[model samples]
Target: MDYLTATKNKKYLMYISQNYSYAILRPLQQEILAQGGEVKWFLEGNEVTSSFLKNNESHLLTIEEVIRWSPDVSFVPGNVIPPFIPGIKVGLFHGFNSGKRNRKGFEDHFNIRGCFDLYCTQGPNTTSRFEQLSKQYKHFAVKETGWPTLDPLFNPDTKSIYTQPDDKRKTLLICSTFSRNLSLAPKLYQTIKTFSEQGKWRILMQFHPKMPNELVTKYQALENENLTFIETDNVLPLLKAADVMLCDTSSILLMFILQRKPVVTFCNQDPGKHLLDVTEPEKVEAAIELALSHPAQLMDDIESFCQQLHPYQDGLSSQRVLAACNELVLTNPKLKPKPLNLIRNLKMRKKLNYWRW
Candidate 1:
């Protein structure tokens, strides 16, 4: 039988606690609906303000309500899967692990703390590591499914098309991560300010939502006729609009590479050959020029990098993820919620105020 035919009425409980998680899981939620499955969202703590729930109010349900529903599968983009939640806890992950900033903790990215019954990996870079860890831990099933969040980038109907503005100046997008040590914003502000004033390029700046409001305000004040500051959960549109991407250690650098576009990184922690790493402030302008002047020069390297990162650029990753979920639901015995991690549970309850005598 076909995939959708098999998942006609499957139930999916998506647990999200941040805009980043919502963005990562939103595509899969839509795909579930298309497959005739019932998908409900449970926002943890402050995630209720997520734009995903803005239009999807009807689909919102409380955590208690979710438990009673006992969905066939519970997907979490963030690290911790809710303790005692019914069904298979699947780790869908939030972003690509580019090994940026010398981050060695799996908890921040790939660590499985008995939270998930299954893990959907983005590519070999992640899958190989998780597979080893899975064997060592003897817990959780790992599947190599390219990130569902990026599926829309490859979809013909949904893919963003870049259109040059009327003035014809190439668009430059500068994105920074939240980590102050790795973020390029504070250090590059003067360089960007100089460039923004020149009017030689159309500049777009996007920062991690977790970035402090003080920093955001500091950058927002820099907006001018040539420079625009963007603050939104969705980045695909911005990615599609830019002719070149300037970034630090953020995984969006990998996404930009997948677009076959040139990316200039500011001393990326986990440096990739394709990315033009610029350390000196004076060299930033020259790197941007090189990218715009010779995009063809790096096409081969970018394609090779993308192949190792995520080979399925055809936009069906969401389908594959849903298929895996459905198959596990039908074939595997219903998973009984494992014994709760008392410490983790208490921490979560305190965080979400789920206290009950």
Candidate 2:
């Protein structure tokens, strides 16, 4: 912790993610500054998300601008690790554990490598996954500090998804999945449609970012008043307003637990492998169905079963993340091969028995 704490007075670099995450990081940035650490943000866009920096009373410099500022530690989030910035230390604030059954396609493609002077991760499982992937390629230097992105969800929500009669009220979520290994989407939609038609529930749609806007517009046009379509980049606020979350394998469901809402994962794998290779369509479907068996109440045992689902969601996650970044910077090696071997290797196995955990 000292290694990370040493950044008490250092000027750190941070790669900005979506608008939602910026809010969570703001307080941490304040703490960093209060301790004499100066923070520079590498934001995605200058529109809405960046606007919060002003209220948080923080500052954001574009990547191009940050290059000129040249801080001691560069923290990376979701975007492709930036190109070479001469004369700067790199600290990786990694977002996704790419290369596993849980990782999304865009997330798995471009991973920031060992070039990071320091690497911070979601947790041990993620470290393990990177290690396993390294066995097939390069080594990784990573520390598990949990996800700072979930900082906003640790606290219980002030409200529920809904309190109306469970059978008559519905909370529909527009959702997406990481890997669809079975014929689950259509069937899952059928399940929701059936439930709604029976006056048991309503639908709210939360579309993925990568999805085409026109497609979302078309889906939103579905003639259903009970269905509320989420079009904004920020979905957490909406998730907070919801009661029951319906989606297929979105990491967001983990956040939904903060709302005490139940989750339903939809798989559409008709004998296809979206992840690297290993996938069990039947088991995935069975697990999700069983978890949602409480059609009357969502997430009957979510808090207890969170470990199997997320594995690294401790509430004070941001502080751990800071420690991880600092640890990497202190121990980070230059141009190491197989930077992520151990982690990737352990988690390369399928997520078959996890739900049972």
Scored by lDDT, the top model is: 1
Cα displacement (Å) at residue 336, model 2: 3.0
| Model 2 C-alpha RMSD to native | 10.2
TM-scores, one per candidate: 0.92, 0.64
RMSD over all Cα atoms, model 1: 2.5
Model 2 residue 100 CA deviation in Å = 6.9
lDDT of 1 by residue, 93-207 (tens): 7778767533563335765577888888888877898899777766567788888998888876774434455758899999999898889988998999899889999988999
Candidate 2 lDDT over 1-357, as tens digits, reads: 476467676767666655655654654565567557788776654433665566445454544466567776665554334434433343334234322242454444235444444345554545665555544444445455666556555556434343335446545454664233422344344444544455444666665555555555655565365655565545556666555555544555556654455655444221112211113333443444344454433344554444533465445566776665556556655534424444432342221111111
Single out the weakest 10-residue window by summed lDDT for candidate 2.
269-278
TM-score for predicted model 1 compared with the true structure:
0.92
lDDT of each: 0.80, 0.50
